[model samples]
Target: MLSEVYPFQETAEAARRVQLNDHLGELGVLCLAPSPGLGVTDATLRSRIGEDRITSLMAA
Candidate 1:
């Protein structure tokens, strides 16, 4: 896995960079590389899969 000094913070920053592109079009700051290491959390999966042990989602 790739790592960076900053991860999600920079990933979100990269999104903002896209926003910046609109103004920097002539300045040519395209293709800003978002740092690797954007990660998934257990909470992230829990949102989709349902975390309750009593009535959790089941697969057929």
Candidate 2:
């Protein structure tokens, strides 16, 4: 989830990083790498997933 909040060091990265990092620290974990194929190239799909948790809650 850290990758989702801080994908890069670019200025455009959202401020959610601090919150996410803190959350991970509370869980006794730190994200070391980004997931493969996690880049948001499809704006439509990304918007859908971001707007609702249903997509993430559903299982294959």
Which has the greatest TM-score? 1
Cα RMSD (Å) between model 1 and the true structure?
13.5
- Segments of candidate 1 deviating more than 4 angstroms: 1-6, 22-60
lDDT of candidate 1 over 24-54, digit per residue (tens): 3222112332422223346766577665542
* Pairs with backbone N, CA or C atoms under 3 Å apart (clashes), candidate 2: none
TM-score each candidate: 0.22, 0.21
Which pairs clash inside model 1? none
